[model samples]
Target chain A: MKKFEHEVIFCIVNAGFSDAVMDAAREFGARGGTVIRARGTANMEAEKLFGITVQPEKELVMILVKSAIKEDILHALYRAVGLNTPGQGIAFSMPVDQVVGLSEAPIEPKAEEQAE
Target chain B: MSEAITKKEKTPIRARAARAPRGSKRIEQVTAPHKLKLLFTIVNRQKAELYADLLQAYDVNMQMFLSAQGTASTEMLQYLGLGDDEKVVIASIIREDLAADALHMLEEKFRTIKNGKGIAYTVPMSGTIGVAVYQFLCNHRGDRV
Candidate 1:
């Protein structure tokens, strides 16, 4: 039998949208995600373009899941957050060469005593 | 509530300093004849933004980033059991002085310190393509036009 492969998706978004993005990710099939604060570098141009203040405040979220579910999770993020929209966010997945803790033996059910 | 208000009012100077424009000379100052490689990571997959932020602090005109998967020791792999994850590598040219500050920030902020979480590092840049490109990278963000 061929061994199964696992993939993980990592994403970083403006901090303001972290919750919404992560929530949608979990809804799709992601077990969980880690969120971290970050700052944006290119956004400095916003000050020149629009006189409005732009905060580089950013949040990064990483999710690990089976490669089979990559498309579903990506779509879920697109629909929920709309990466096309400014500050909405982006998502992508990479193949995992080696995985640990993913292989576990199945557990047997306890025998039941039936009285006729 | 009163205590919370007092804490908010007493915000540290460093927090306030972080909000201001990083030195406008970051671009020019960082590139002005320096021998340092601006090492960065794209494991989080936010290149453009991260680069932009760096430019605000240093004058890194030219940079190259490579996609890489995060790798861990077999023991760490088994202990943490990160199923399938990879780390990305981003390397750029920067001045020696700017490289030190960048490394400092990376150590204090990006790396796993008190929390023991994510991690990254930087190395000194040794060689380069040409002087013109080197100057351009350092001169882009100089306060003077």
Candidate 2:
């Protein structure tokens, strides 16, 4: 079996909160992610059990991160958008077999870093 | 700036590894051992429809697009010609082997089309809900489905 080096972390949150998801992830070394517009289908019973109105307008954020930082990014995402928050997001990850087109080029130094 | 453009120009070389689909070869030969893989092709909003159309030729039956925002830094996004920052995530159900051909096609389009650069990766799917649904998702153009 081939070992995987990257994982695509999927976070589904209430619409308009995708930016919040990315902000949380960026702090933890995630380069970025893509958002897929989606809708929530939780039955009323589940929504009532969770004590939150389920927002049908949802945003599925797909962030491809190195496996080493997967846990941190997931945790960051949970804190930022988990069910307790208005976003009421759920997050999970899947292993990636192969990737092409994106690369790990060096990010340009920010102003402070460049000054140093 | 020129260096960035050069890297973008050379991006196709990386995808050359996926063998171009040969007409003479039978589809069954490449698809026999493989199962369905989720092909996540993220591209600019403008090019999503074209990709979706091209993928169907390679046995991809289901393709869903999600409006997205790219997280690349400002400079990087500028270099990739994604000034608007709008993106589309095309999630397609493609067989493991056929994905290679689709990926090759994506690379070609990326090189030729202005601001057509995109990222493509696959995650292996473990199981499907039903055989009928699976067959439909992997529709082989009415040939031996």
Best by DockQ: 2
TM-score (all chains, Cα) for each model: 0.37, 0.74
Best by lDDT: 2
lDDT by residue (B1-145, candidate 1, tens digit) is: 9999888877875565666557655334554344555444334444334543654566666666554443332336657775444443455556666766665555444444332223333444456677666667665434657
The i-RMS of every model, in angstroms, reads 12.7, 1.7
Which residue window of length 10 is worst by lDDT in model 2 chain B? B24-33
Assess each model's interface with DockQ, reporting 2 decimals per model. Answer: 0.02, 0.47
RMSD of candidate 2 to the truth, in angstroms, is 16.0
Q: What is the TM-score of chain A alone in each candidate?
A: 0.69, 0.86
Clashing pairs in 2: none
Candidate 1 segments whose C-alpha is farther than 4 A from its true place: A1-4, A50-53, A84-87, A102-116, B1-145
Per-residue lDDT for B1-145 in model 2, tens only? 9999999988885555345445535433554533899999989888889889988888887888878877655667689885766888888999887887888888778778898888888899998887678778777444662
Cα distance off (Å), candidate 1, residue B73: 28
